[model samples]
Target: MSHLRIVRDEPPKRRERRPHVNHVLTHAEQAQARAALKGLRNAFGSWSALAAAMDVRITTLMAAARGAYNVSAALLVRASRASGLSIGDLLGKPIAADRCRACGQIKRRVA
Candidate 1:
């Protein structure tokens, strides 16, 4: 006589958590990021190229450049190293400025 055996399936494993996702940048910071992205994009000719050179994702680079989200510091270092530029140069200079009535603060454009 032969005996029959039953087997049970295991549950799927959960993915490890990444850094805090939804950490949006401030208005001024967004401006700076966009400006910096412009220069980096120019150098690489495209967001994909830049991200590829930095070993990161194109979407991440695009979002960071468009000010849609903040970039990781490690990515920043990678960009700077890959471009042979300092952090200051990557984050281009400001272009315009205006006073805020609500907070009585001055905001400047980053070019």
Candidate 2:
């Protein structure tokens, strides 16, 4: 039998760890934001498309989602309309009735 050739693989390099930024929100907040993003995406497809339709920059919504900025209740309402969702849905809050507050009609998420 021929002598076996020995080859040792190098260990993988450890990734450089960066210091955590204080501006980032806690895990819980990130979860909520992620949920909100899911709801929004379900409604409007993508943030970029939704922003284009709403005439707002995508970065604005991104900033809000990442906790780098805050959006007002009114802006949230507008975004809700733009995304074909309700404010409660966008915020991951459940509406008690799931009915239209305007006309008392049964309503779905988008319509």
| Tens-digit lDDT track of model 1 for 51-81 | 8888888888888777676765666678778
C-alpha RMSD by candidate, in order = 9.7, 12.1
Deviation in angstroms for 85 in model 1?
Answer: 0.5
Model 2 alpha-carbon drift over 4 Å, by segment: 1-34, 92-111
lDDT of each: 0.67, 0.60
Candidate 2 lDDT over 27-109, as tens digits, reads 55455544665455545678887677666778887776666765545446666677576655555543334455456587776
Cα error, residue 59 of model 2, in Å, equals: 1.1
lDDT of model number 1? 0.67
Which candidate achieves the best TM-score against the true structure?
1
Off by more than 4 A, model 1? 1-30, 92-111
